[model samples]
Target chain A: MKHTLSVLVQNKPGVLARTAGLFSRRGYNIESLTVGVTENENVSRMTIVVTGDDTVVEQVTKQLNKLIEVIKVSDLTKESYVDRELVLIKVTADGSNRGEIMQLVDVFRARIVDVAAKSLIVEVTGDEEKIVALIAMLKQFGIKEIVRTGTLALGRGPKVIQSGKD
Target chain B: MNLTGAKALIKSLEYEHVDTIFGIPGGVVIPIYDELYQQDAITHYLVRHEQAAAHAADGYARATGKVGVCMATSGPGATNLVTGIATAYMDSVPMIAITGQVTTDLIGNDAFQEANITGITQPVTKHNYLLHDASEIPQTIKEAFHIASTGRPGPVLIDIPKDVQTMTAPFDYPKKVHLPGYQPTYEGHPGQIKRAAKAISEAHRPVIYVGGGVKISGASEEVRALAETILAPVTMTLMGMGTMPADHPLSLGMLGMHGTRYANYAVTESDLIIAIGARFDDRVTGKIASFAPNAKIIHIDIDPAEIGKNVRVDIPIVGDVKRVLQKLMPMLKQTRTKEWMEKVHTWKREYPLEFEVTGLRPQYVVREISRLCPDAVVCTEVGQHQMWAAQYFSHRHPRNFISSGGLGTMGYGFPASIGAKIGRPDETVFDLAGDGSFTMNCQELATAVAYDVQVKVAIFNNGYLGMVRQWQELFYDRRYSQTKLSEINFVKLADAFGAHGIRVDSASEVAPAIKEALAVPKPVIIDFRIEPEECVWPMVPAGAALNEIIDAKSGKV
Candidate 1:
């Protein structure tokens, strides 16, 4: 199974390499990973997508927490919180198919970021469900390129919660 | 805070008095490497392989009684350091492995090159770091070094992402660190120390069983002082070599399957056994129920978990070996037991380190190396030569003999010797290896060549995995069972990696090979072929008591 995890850590040199090194050495297939600053400057949050046994992900979480740099790790797939992913999709949309693509884009509320001779880049933001639906609708137009921010999550009904700092 | 991370690392090392680091360059690690480069305060060496870098760092840590640091890039570069990290972890050498990571956004998008290195190294490392923010670097680094160098010291992995590296953070190197759950006991409790001293002072015959912790914690002098004060015989674990002079009057050599006769005799007859820094591994205490049968065992160690791990402890002194000895010294009454000393002397005279010189001898190779390097720090890979070095080398100082004693890891000698050399650069470092054991990690020769760290490797080139072969020959009715090994040309292999290499087939050439190898001031490998049947003598048959050593096939016992 593939699982996406959000981890908060003390941003510093060597932290990324050590985290990545762990997955590879253990032969865990890392499907995707994204790390960026959180609301707080001291903590940088990572969105990691990995394919492994259910048990392996939990083991990885425990091990990740053991690192001095890692403040906390949450298996977002199992957590009840607000999470969103932003994906930019470049689809086939020239004069011949422009009208049909625009109607579909309007329904999804996705914006056209860039327009080329035969392709239009559509920016869509939602959870995995909305993004997957948008990608499926654009499949007929052909997907020239696709880029995603993976998933960043925040626990619901928070009081300015520090995800793993507690 | 940059100061916090850097200072934490430096402060933890200062506790160990570490003076050096070995690493290389990369994008993510620039922040750290830059800090180190600008600091003339701590010496940093640039080595070739990230793997070599880590091993060299481990060598420095083990040799110097300090924590060693090595750095590398993200993805493959960081992954390359895994083998060396595992090496240090297996051998219990304190090392901190640092690697760079991709910027935050590139982390999970399959963007560019990035790997989850901390997860990869978790099993092998004592602790690790995956710093998400730039500010926590110092505190994490300090924690890494602290966890690595304390208790059963092992490797710690720290991964720093690129963005965090570039982020501006207040760099305040800490002079002290506050780790809530990480208190290490350095002094044995006063009550336990007094009880132990009373036992030693009251015993009719006493024995001190010393192990690697003695050498690691620099308690040899204190151990010897305590032993002499109590007038007890000393038997060293393989790791305990150099805990006290092997040739000391009270020293009874090594104790185990192939331990010296005097060491086993003292173990068998003693009324009180003082085990300091030594874990009672199965190899040392063959049949636990029968080991030191007549003795009341007093166990002293820094790790509370190890106090009663194997053998039951009559008195457990939970503290550092040196501090425990210091406290116990004043509490004990000094004595000169002439009769017990006389018996141990007799055992030494009878079953000496005597082997027939007619055939190719592993002991001869070790003896020659020891002859040239009276003060050399000897490390060994696990096998026949490991036992030989433990027996043949006359270790006079503490922390001079580094080997994988507890775990008995095979590829230990090569890298551990590198660590020992880095620890004590003034003293020559020699890795005494069996052919089978040497081949396990001979790739580390590149580490030596990269840093120009001089380490001499004397390969006891037996055609088989000598230790396993001996067990099969003696107990399994010569069912080799894949113990037979392939031929490896040591000179060619070492030369392939840009190291000085030689093959010595004659006994007379032993001294010359070691002397020439030592003179080059670079890593050198010397291979010595010996008869396959050659065994480390005073062999205790499997499942037998300590004193029940076979001595040899013909029954010298």
Candidate 2:
């Protein structure tokens, strides 16, 4: 099972290493992780996607909470949450298939951010499933390169996982 | 007042009421050592090895319930402290390890005597800091102490660059720390406590399993009270030794891999396991699935992650053991467990801990030491001597028996005993060591002698790594492979260090040598040449279930 966790931590040196090192050291499976500054400049929010059962995920959340720099951990897997991952796929598109690629991009509501003589870079932002589906579709067009922003997640409602002091 | 980071560091330690430190001076730490020289409040014991310094600090922490402090310079000095730090972290000992790093500019350049200590120690330390500025000293030191000594206490490291230490800053130690992420839940949930209490009252064959957490939390009395209230037998894990009086009627010696047969049987047959301050370690739970097969477990620990890490916890109470026990004690109703008690008693009587009385056995040496110095603080180096000490010595108070439970580091006992003695000068301190384990840090005899820290070390000189040898004999077709240790005349070694020394080859000479060693006012090492092939009995083979324990007669009980 996949569980997405929202972790708020102090935006200090080695906090990321400390958090990431924990998962590696404990042999916990990390599917994806994205970190960015939160509403407060001093705090950073990390959306970590981990693969584990309920018990293992619970242990992961508890262990993450144990880190001194970590402010809070909210498992958003069960909650109604919105998650997105931005991906860029540079496809080998020449005059022959450029129109077809643009048509496919339009149907998927993606943008052709960069165009070169032999390639077109399509940028798309959506949930993981949508991006994965778009990538699979672009693979047939001979994808030159693909990059993903992992996953960024938030609760669907106004429920916040921030430092209580804030 | 304006002061350099080094001075401020010393000042912050004084504010924390740190009376002693175990450390070794090095290139990067010279500035810190210079400041230490100007200090009168903290007495620093210059240890021979950086590792010993950390272990000694850990020993002091275990004995005094105060945060133990140690220091080392960067690179090799800092790397040496890794094992000691991991040892403390594993056992949940409160410790603060200060390391002097290369200057900030050279941190990533691999300058002279440089190491990224914070990065190296991240996996081992509970928390660590790499300070680049002088002004962060006071707050960092305060937070280091606070984090190290708080809930689920463990080792915390603060790495100060040499230039940072030389930089000047205003010194103002923070009165209180503001760590929003580090608040430990000291009180159990009311609903969970009620559920646990109800389960305890309903259990007819309940066994109270205790571990190092009880000692760390200072909950020995609470554990005993709970055991008495519930009329449950108390079985201690290796680290839980000294948390409950061994002679108490409810006490079932140490449990787990090398645990007593009765303790294993009791846990196996238990209807309810009231585990306080204990993690279900693999050593404690032979085969996890089969461990306490008949029981519903109530795991009470300060660390929530430990609740169901291994065992399936029926009732999980995340709180300090002392506070949780206090809340749950009143809600408990005593159950009638006469039949269960009789069965446990029968197992105890049938599978008593015994060894052949023919030769000078290591167990006999430990027993004599325990008999003579019943009130002494006992520490042990890893291997056969450690298990024998755990089995033979009777501990009656928290921190009385300090050994590396989780990491099982060799060479832990001697320096640790010195630290233990320094912490509690009134009590006798003994290090039950094996020849293989003792020589790892025997250089600390100089530190012990110089400081007049009178700690007795009983070296079970078996001329082989007895524990590994025993394992080979039983499981590996008796191929000894590298287990044979080269002999060293420990008496001569002790004499060279200006400490007293004695060698006893016979069981009859053990008692007299201990008495003579006790009379000496300095460090003493009594090397006892024992049966080379002796093994710690009541063994549960690796990966074997608790019920399949092999007894003294080599029969499955």
Candidate 3:
């Protein structure tokens, strides 16, 4: 099964590597991960997608929490949460096919973020499935380049995952 | 008054009650050494090799339950401590390893005598720090010691740059550390304890499988109480040997690859396995899928990471072993397991460990050591000698037996014995070592004699790397390539180093030599000429089922 975990860790050099090192050393499977600064400058939040059984996920959560840099870890798999991934894809759109690609982008509710003499750069932000689907549709037109930010997540409503000190 | 970072570091160590430091001085660490020379609060023991310093500190901690401290200079010095650091990490020994680094400006420039010690030790340490400023020295040192001694207890590293060490800072060690991420759970959950207690009371064929955690948490008494009340026989892992009295009727000597036949049988047949302070290592489990096949496991460990790391735990209680057992003991109902006890007794009687009596048996040497130094803190180097000591030495207290359990590092015993002697001067300390391992750190004999550490080192001189030779004889068709060792005149070496030395070639001389070595006022080395081809028996080849053991003595099982 797939589990999403939101981990809060102290802002410091090598903290990300150490947190990720635990997962790799213990052989825990990580599907996708995204880390960025949080509301506080001294803290950073990491949203990791892990695929394992109940026991494996539990061990990962506990092990992550054991790291000295990590302040808090929560498995958001069973909770209501919004997850998003942003992808910038450049596809061949010279002349005749430009209108057709723009039409497809409009249908998918994505926007053209950049334009080149030979191609158009489409920006899409949504859940993994929507981003994946948009990428698949754009692949019909020759894809020149693609970059994706791995999934980031937040819980719904007033529930906030805070550090122990906070 | 403002003090240099090096002085502040020393002050913080004093604040943490660290009186002894095992370290070697070098270029980057000269500033700290200069400051140390000016202070009388902490005594320093100079080691020939940085590795031995770490091992000695580990021995001190294991023997006395205090956080051991070791220091080394940059580059080669810091790298040399890796094996010992990993050794302490594997066994969960509480240790603080401080290394002096190149100046901050030259950190990544590949400057002379520079090394990224923290980066190198990342996986082995519980936590590590590289100071960015001089003022952070006191708090970092406090945090390092706290992390090293608290919770599951493992080695922590602090790498201080030379520039930072020379910078001036106000010395004020923090009274308490505030690490929001590192709080350890000490008390077991009430519902889980109740469940565990109920399960123990109801278990018919129950076995308490003990591990090093029992000793680490000082929970031997609590374990004994719970075991006796529930009438469960105890089988301990190699690291768990001294956690309970070895002579106790319920105690099943060391269990694992070289574990006894009956202990393996009992575990296989048991209905409930109460695992305490032990992660199921591959050596202990043989084949994980088949280990304790009929048993439902109740694992009690302080580290949540270890609860299901290797084995599937049916009931997991995450807490300090001592605290968890103390709470669970009262909730448990006393019960008798007469039928199970009878079966276990029969197995024990039928399959006692035996060896041919013709030549000088290593087991006899170990037994003599135990008899002579009954209260001694025993340390061992890795290999066949370690196994024999684990099997034969009768340990009466929790801290009595110390060895390189987790990492199984060679050449650990001698220096560790020195550390143990320093930690507990009132008690005798012995290093049961093999010729191969003794040669690794025998240079430390000078350190011992100079300081009068008075640790007895008994070498099992088989003229070969006995354990590797055994593997070759059994599995590789007796091709002893590089197994035979070049000879050394230990007695002459000891004399040159100003220590007592005795060599015995026969079984009759074993006891007398040990007696003589024990009476010596200074450090002593007794070299015993053991049978070259002797192998540890009841061997379960790696990955084999526990029951499929090779009993070469009788040529029968």
Encode model 2's per-residue lDDT on B254-339: one tens digit a residue: 99999998999999999999999999899999998899988999999999999899989999999999999998888887788889
Interface C-alpha RMSD after superposing true interface residues, each candidate, one decimal:
7.2, 1.1, 1.5
Q: For candidate 3, lDDT tens digit of each residue in B289-407?
A: 88999889999999998988888888999999999998988888766689999999999999988876778889899988999889889999999999999888888888989989888
* TM-scores, each model vs. reference: 0.71, 0.99, 0.98
Ranking by DockQ: 2, 3, 1
Point out where model 1 deviates above 4 Å. Answer: A1-166, B1-19, B23-51, B74-92, B102-117, B150-152, B494-498, B520-522, B541-543, B554-557
The RMSD (Cα, Å) of candidate 2 is: 1.2
Score candidate 1 by lDDT. Answer: 0.78
Number of the predicted model whose lDDT against the real structure is largest? 2
Chain B, per-candidate TM-score: 0.88, 0.99, 0.98
DockQ of all candidate complexes: 0.05, 0.82, 0.70
DockQ of 1: 0.05
The Cα local distance difference test for each model comes to 0.78, 0.92, 0.90
Residue pairs with colliding backbones in model 2 are none
